[model samples]
Target chain A: MNIKHSLLNIFQDNPTCWQLILDQALYGYLISQKNSPENFYINPALQEHLKLLLTDFKSEEFSFEIKEPLEKSEAKSIKTEAYFFLNGKKIASKKAHFLSFSFQQEEFYIAVFSSEKITRANAYQKTYDVGLAEKLKISEKAFQNNFEYGATGMALVSLEGKWLKVNKRISLMLGYTKEELFKLTFQDITVPEDLEKDLSLLKRLLDGEIDHYQLEKRYYHKNGSIVYAILAVSIVKNNDGLNLYFISQLIDITEMKRAEKRIKKLFKKSKEQNERLENFAHIVSHNLRSHAGNFSMLLELYESQLDEEDEIITMLSSASSNLQETIEHLSEIVNMHNSIKNTMESIAVLPVAKKTIENLSSQIQQHNLKITLAVDASLKVKAVPAYLESIFLNFISNAIKYSSPSKASFLEVNAEVEDAFIRIDFKDNGLGIDLEKHGHKLFKMYKTFHEHEDARGIGLFLTKNQIQAMGGKIEVESAVDEGTTFSIYLKKTT
Target chain B: MSTLKLTCIIDDDPIYVFGIQKVMDVINFCESTLIFKNGRDALDNLSSIIENNENIPDVILLDLNMPIMDGWEFLDEFIKIPSPKKVYIYVISSSIDPKDVNRVKRYQDVKNYIIKPVGPEQLSTILKDFKEDNFS
Candidate 1:
């Protein structure tokens, strides 16, 4: 009916043309009786092609099956693209034409088999492969640039500890060239004392015990100097979980380490000098106070024995009292230095402030200052009891002593719990300090702001030392002739 | 309360000892007084007094810092002795150190800690407290 069926019948009827068709290069030919599907002949060229594509290709075991039914009178042909299997194992896919016809009297079948030809889809696949190769080349160039120009030293090491690749920074850090570094393993450049630790960590990484490791290690520079670096290392693995290479990055810290050593040496020297100074001050204060005490006692005894006040005795008595006062102040400072050894305890702030205010009640009443204590009853601070009491005494007394005579003065003592500290504010509307001129020297010894008769200038200095010894700090806010606010931050007790 | 029969002073400073003794006489602090230059002299004399079963002083004014033995060492040895009388010990020192003051409170025999230049007022308070303890 069709030209294709007519040509197929003509080819099937002529046995001479069958040989010509079997000799074709574009297709492989196979002939079989219609009833014997297992017995067939495979052309030599296709058998050679099968031997290349399959695990084992045997001509004797080759078989064919025509899934479409054949009519009884006219010739029927079927074309199919199917997979060929030998002994249940897939070999290859082939396009085949099966022509069922009567050659003489019995029915016979001729099959034409061909490998898949190169179509437009295959051509596109070929171009896609070329594009993938070009992209891979560009990415490899980018990787090379990163490895070569990175800031820190980088290296790729083999599993056997051999240096596989090294960047320029690694070469410079080790005082070796890139070519020279590759000839040696990382162990060769590492300091012997640090080798064992590095090797053990690397072993752990290789054993899958740790994903990565970082350590401060030492390496020997080419010039025999010790180089300090912070080394971070991780392993690269293949899809099959095989050890590929180690990626190591090293940051130089030799300068930092040298500076740290210098700082420590200086700190030790300063601490020793400070201890000696403290001891000297302690001895001086102790001896001076003892002599001053005896001098005052003798002066008092002399004055008591005399019926009338002697001018010389009175002058000596005043001098002795001044001497005693100076020595007392000196001893107080020396004692403040020793207060660090005192034990700290949590004491309620309100009770201590209340007691201090009560002790200075006469002075407060004399000054006619309204002293309002706004400290919470529940708030507590961590401090040495004596230091805390002295702190409160110095601030409250100073407030009373500096109260303004022109106006009704008010001193507000407020305590609030802040972050990790108890902030106590001693704010007084009194004769405020000229902080612009005296701010820098406000807390220095013997630096008095006002000409008040009782302003010794030692109170603030002593108070600051005591506060600091208890791990606290003091801040002052003042304005001339207006007011002064002293805020002390003490450790809050949970 | 009646006056104490006897009082003892143990100090290293002669000036301080002289001043205290004069003040005691002026205040009519006790009927009699015994003095030692340091804690060692007082400890030895007190140990002898205890051995003889004589009248131990009613009050002991102990100074902390001394040449041979300090007041702390004297108290350590005196408390070990089994005495016939209950003597009240008071630590009087020039040291205004809180540590020294707090250390004195640890001794049961120590009645109080007094800072020096004790003058008349502190001595009067001590005498009154002693009379109170005796008569109350």
Candidate 2:
């Protein structure tokens, strides 16, 4: 008959014998059958009872029925429930646990039994309960709202590089919705240049070589901007020793990257400005001083040459004039350098232009030049007051000085607001320059293009420097014998 | 009473050269004088003189700044020539910068650093030194 029928017969006919077999099984006694043998050693008193039962039931027909199929327990062992019977009568029920392991191609099953009536707790069962509680605590903590909503991004990725789950923070950090992100792989969002490194680290983890890895990598946001992050990844494995998914944590560092770029750019700009200042100082020390020293030596020589008094006097007078001119230029440059750190103020541009025109009224009247001003009286720019006046003065004086002798000269000044700058245009009908020939040196010190008595070649250079010191820029356009237009871009006062 | 046999003036400034020539006339500085507008001209002519086995000048008044081959470059090239007679070089420059003065000392052939408008007294002292050495 079936094992169940046989178990029922044993349980009914030999109830004491079934109890003795279960007692021995629970107390770590070996029960050998025709071809299979089982061993247990949980207790000693039950073993004596099982030994006596084994001798008495040796000739009796006995069988057992598994009431429940063997399945993996929470403690990582096979567990099942079974019933024993003799002469078609049920005698006992048992809960059996087996730890199946393999060594050298041989499979072994070590079983532990618990009787229905006896509530004996085994070490494996106790460990199983504690392990289950600890796992629940960890899962509960991980799924808490605080952890999911933290500032740092966290995600779970599959072994194939697809994102299985992502917290709200990671979704927001990448500028993608949760639903949209779930459809994409980690490789899709990673920057192409950083994907290779990430893949290699993942390979090591999948090969069971590393527990986790951390790296600084770039990710692409939904808007196609680069996002810098410190990425930490750890692999979670299943009981079969395979990767279930990856736990990834990313710390955003985009702001820090932008700040570093800004600092580097600022450092380079300041270095260039310092180099220019040093070159200017060298010119002042050598070029200007050499001319002055020559004058002093010539004057002393003239004292001994009494016969050629008039000729020597003329030479000395010319030398002194040149020296005086050089000194004035040097002083102007020094003044501009000193005022570089001057605080800016909102000054009306029209009034400054008017004042500069008034200062040059005599020259204008002498030349019979016509002047037109179209700037608004309320137009103001952020600049040093002294620099504003000086800039206007230089532009107006230059227009008058370079007036064309062929025709009566006219000056037109106007201002317009453009974006963040107030663009002031000074158009003069004068002897315009051939920009192709002199454009490069137009704002350089001591570079004279036109042969004019008043062209010291220092006005435009100083004006350019002054404008730059006030956070402004100057541009010029000219053609030979036509006219010149100077455009000054000044930062507008808010 | 002129102890100097020959003197050379290598300068680009005509006015300063004229002044020095007038002063030399008053002092009876040398029997003959040679002039070059720049250091390159002086170097080329002097090199040719050496090649031709001609008599070289006893003294050279060199100006530092010129159109081509400045005094420093001329000195650098001149020292390599194998000369039979010792030629003393005086660097006359309008630069009062101490760096220039120190640089002049680097050239062993350069005997003195004179500022512009070299007075008769300075020339007389240089002549006195030359006469004393010649006698000794």
Candidate 3:
């Protein structure tokens, strides 16, 4: 029985037995003081029983005896019993390990001291039985929060393509919630076109032939839209001797895909244009060359037969003039071909813009055009200086010539830094071409839209070719009546 | 039949063909000469000759540029023939393009690249390489 239980059992007796118990308790106390040694040594078993009875008496009012060093007598007394203290008093000095015995078998009273230290209750900690639960609770809360939310489309897959775990980013990228994502396998979501290659790469990874695999592949979104992604799958072994998992860092590259598609179309167009140019080169080399050779032959015949030439001197003169004109045309074409500017010289934008303005000073003042330049002054671009001047002069002259005579012409040239590219926008308030109808042939040679007699269509063609050769591109946005805006994207070399 | 019965001339330019003929006459070269404007016309005649098992052109003077099919294109198509026949192709042009000259030399069947304005000396050299007499 515990101490409280033994004490309670002693005090909870009936009134008829209360006085007897109290008297016995008093006798035990007095007898203990009188002959402490004799009391213990008289009956060896009875001394222990008497000590238990005295120890059972509840009250902290007893005077404790200072027993001297057990010099033979005290030591002999202890042979029959043990010594115990209660409430700073030697209440029981006996050998009894048992304190109280009840009439009912299950009601024995004994002292029970709880050895568990008291601390505040942690999460769901009802009893002191479980240790370090409070510390574990604090650490677990921190650990649970450590599994951060955004992780750039993370997917934890088994080596066999089973979806083990996935983060919120992957779920969002795949257009599925976490609950829905766990139910699907990677093979199910992978594009059929990329499945075989990805699986082969994954097999190589599992065999340790490769550390990881990164590829731009497509995944089926939950909404049936194709999501282009840069997928990097890394193999990770579990700390527990479980299966290896693949951590896929999928970056949604749908924008990159769109850009790629645009670039592919642009490349196809340029390739077709190059093929056309090759055909044109062949035509010029054949037909024009034959004409030139024929014109020279006619001269040779005239020189050989001067008497026949006197009769056809006017015809010969006209032929010679026509030949000269043809030669001039050929020379023009050759000059245009040779003037394909492709120098990668990095020059400050400020100086070039200032020179272009100065070169077009008369036209700018003549047309009374309001010009604004918001280019980054310290910005340097890699391009041929002559080509830049030609492009600027052509654009500025066109703006001056084609602008509305009613209102003052406005021109704006500005540059903004984009990732890996410098985008320069040249805006002009001028007679814009109908792009919806004629945009395809805007950069084609001999294609003209304006009624201006001097608008030779070669300027835009040469400009486009020059820009393309310098690793830049030009895109024009215009309406027939509104205005024209050229968005030129040039790669930043340095 | 022992001598060259028919020497063929294949060129789009009539003036160049006339000039070659005059040079050939000056050098007292082959009398029977055939003319073709482009590779397509020449290949057509050659293919017919091949089908009939007749005498094909001993020497083909090809130009790089033409209306239908150019010289290089015709050469690529012509080499696919299964028949075991000996033929020499010569590229004649005024094009000073070094790339074209180097490319023509890479063809195993091409004998030489001759620049235009053919003269008696050029014809004599070809006749000498053929190991034939000056006049046939």
Interface RMSD of each: 1.5, 5.7, 4.7
* Cα lDDT of model 3 by residue, A1-494, tens digit: 58666766666765545545434331122223232322211122222232333424333333333233223212122212334445565544432222223343322222111112111222114332233564567676774454336556777788778777777778878998878877888889989998999999998888778888999888999999999999898888667644378888888988888999999999999999988986776555445655555454445444544654464666676776566455444444544444435335776766777788898888889889888999987676678787677777777777777777777789898988788778878798778889989999998876889888887777787777767766789999988667899877766645
Q: Which candidate ranks first by lDDT, i.e. highest?
A: 1
RMSD of 1: 13.1
State which candidate, 1 or 3, has the greater lDDT. 1
Model 2 regions lying over 4 Å from their true place = A1-129, A132-136, A139-147, A159-161, A186-214, A237-244, A306-494, B1-5, B9-42, B63-73, B93-103, B115-125
Stretches of model 1 off by over 4 angstroms after superposition: A1-146, A156-165, A179-192, A195-214, A222-225, A232-249, A262-288, A298-316, A327-430, A459-478, A481-494, B1-59, B65-70, B118-136
Q: Indicate the DockQ of the complex predicted as candidate 2.
A: 0.11
Q: Model 1, residue A485: displacement in angstroms?
A: 5.0
What's the CA error at residue B103 for candidate 3, in Å?
9.6
Better of 1 and 2 by lDDT: 1
TM-score of each: 0.61, 0.47, 0.38
**What is the per-residue lDDT of model 2 for residues A107-154, given as tens digits with 9 covering 90 to 100?**
444455543323333533543465567666777787766558878898
The TM-score of candidate 2 is 0.47
CA lDDT of each prediction against the hidden true structure: 0.83, 0.77, 0.66
Native contact fraction (fnat) of model 1 = 0.36
Alpha carbon lDDT at A493, candidate 2: 83
